[model samples]
Target: MSRRASGPTEGAVELRGIVKRFPGVLANDDVDFSVARGEVHALLGENGAGKTTLMSILSGAYRPDAGTVSVGGAAMSFKSPKQAIEAGIGMVHQHFRLVQPLSVAENVLLGAPSSFRLAGNATEDRVAELAEAYGIRVNPSAKIWQLSVGEQQRVEILKALFREARVLILDEPTAVLTPQEATHLFSIMRKIASEGRAVIFISHKLDEVMAVADRVTVLRAGRRVATLAIGDSDKSELAKLMVGREVMFRVARGDHEPGAPHLTVDGLAATGDLGLPALRDVTLEVRAGEILGVAGVAGNGQRELTEVIAGLRPATSGTVAIGDRDLSASAPAERIAAGLGYVPEDRLGTGLIPSLGCIDNVMLKRTDEF
Candidate 1:
């Protein structure tokens, strides 16, 4: 067995009694977590469980209500992600920060080298070599909008590599990835850990966590409940740890009983905010009680379509119909009445209110009015 195949890797990070609060809820309270150098440690929890809030503290995106963040036995306080980056820490969010029109190399080196410098072919050439070495294949010259979710994720990983991050944190990395893309991500993660870099992965998928994690830590209601070795625990065990009891994930349906379409977009064509044609006369329909997974590369027409249907963005041409009502010229209020349940890609920017509670955030539209 290799040295890294055993216990925690070297440059360890420790969190002691961390506490974070937001209004009525304690997001994280006295939370303790540690990642040994070169270990692929998993943080598992349900949505809104505060796993992300804890990671945010470590990444300098949020200041803990109270706690200490010590890395490699050194005491340090991070005021911004810049400080964390300088300390060799990097975070890749579920929603990518890459500019859709920019090339992969440009995205990786956006703030690297000198902005005044030309960012010549030499940088992209180096990026290609590094990507090949790391088994992360992404076209340096290709636009971000053209690449699939998985490929774009690889680009995000490469950004950390370019930034010289030793402790890498990925928040819900596979949420938008296909099975194949997720497999690629796992391979890359294993490769990264094998090279003596610490990897902290945040996820809700228990199977994925069990598949990749050396040590799985479960958090519930903003508290760490259990941390178990992957080899010793099964899926049921981890699920128990996550939710405090058994939870059924699968539900059987009686028949193929999809109701009438609740939302419809016919021959939707739109000009992007930049005055370019965003959608390509696309047509689709979404029924109530159904989850429509629009599979495509980042920034293709998926986001534009969602926005147009949500009444967030207006289409140049094409009609959006909710039920039997054509809502092409209708505002968001009108679309809502037509039974549109839209979840925008930019949830932070478009969907939820920052100062609102979770339940309040959900009830904002109905509760506020009624």
Candidate 2:
């Protein structure tokens, strides 16, 4: 592995006048960002505000149209992800990339340098040691598919540590975590930053930013709006900075008696994309005039449950009822014909055709009516 400079600097990682453009859109506009050693820097912005684009430039996924990047106070141009990794930079993307069949230790040592490599037992031992020291726990011998989202995230962290990364960029690290899991991750992130390394946490959740970050930088419309110490800011301040206006936090759920059942599922069983029993004998009911919420950590079979109910996936066993009709064995079209209106998690890809206009896409499920 390539080594960066040996001592502390003003900025562990810094970008100056960074600008990135694609056709008619300027994704990042002369953005300046810096994270110092031993600091937990939170990058905050709404979707399409250039937070990810700026980090992508730093990670070498995309080269900048203009600007300078410096690592450990030395100006550097990174052509690829490998080059950035060589310069003590590591990034864990929102979507994890892991070989499902590979063991945890194998995944950690997969792309690491020979010096960081060890045989089976040694690698497992090292992983255990790192997990203990960092407050992250995972079985080194377990395959990726066997682990939960939190455990997979721990493996990602271990991968960064194994690579000797001095600066770690985590994009929406807690999105898949449960509340308790998110707390655990925050503690682990604190440990990482306390070791005199730089940690850039990218998140849109204001509560988490306030909880974990030492410093917060808000981006709006591809520009840096504010960068302030966490102690100097509050949720409202950060929210205003992100949206360019004052915001209101209010929810009005009027009291009303729920009507008869509209949708019901009993003893629902379904498999995930990995062919695992993601939904196991789950039961739920939604009344005609009520909104029933199903909440859990990501990968806890929410998607599978939805797919099974929407008739996109075959249930291993169970009954789905919309009003008085049982649609357990029905196909998606059949379910739709039975008066079930469903919208998937991915709006652009699954809910609507990106290339089609509003009217055309709206007519997809109602072609006969159109």
User: Which pairs clash inside model 2?
Assistant: none
Model 1 residue 344 distance off true place after TM-score fit, in angstroms? 5.4
Clashes of 2: 0
Question: For model 1, what is the C-alpha lDDT against the true structure?
Answer: 0.83
Task: Show the lowest summed lDDT stretch of 10 residues, model 1.
Answer: 111-120
Q: In candidate 1, what are the lDDT values of residues 44-146, reduced to their tens digit?
A: 9988899889988988889998989988788869998877777778899977899998988888888653432334697788779779988898988888989
* Model 2 TM: 0.89
Q: How much lDDT does candidate 2 score?
A: 0.88
> Top TM-score: which candidate number?
2
**Range of the 10 consecutive residues with the lowest summed lDDT in candidate 2:** 1-10
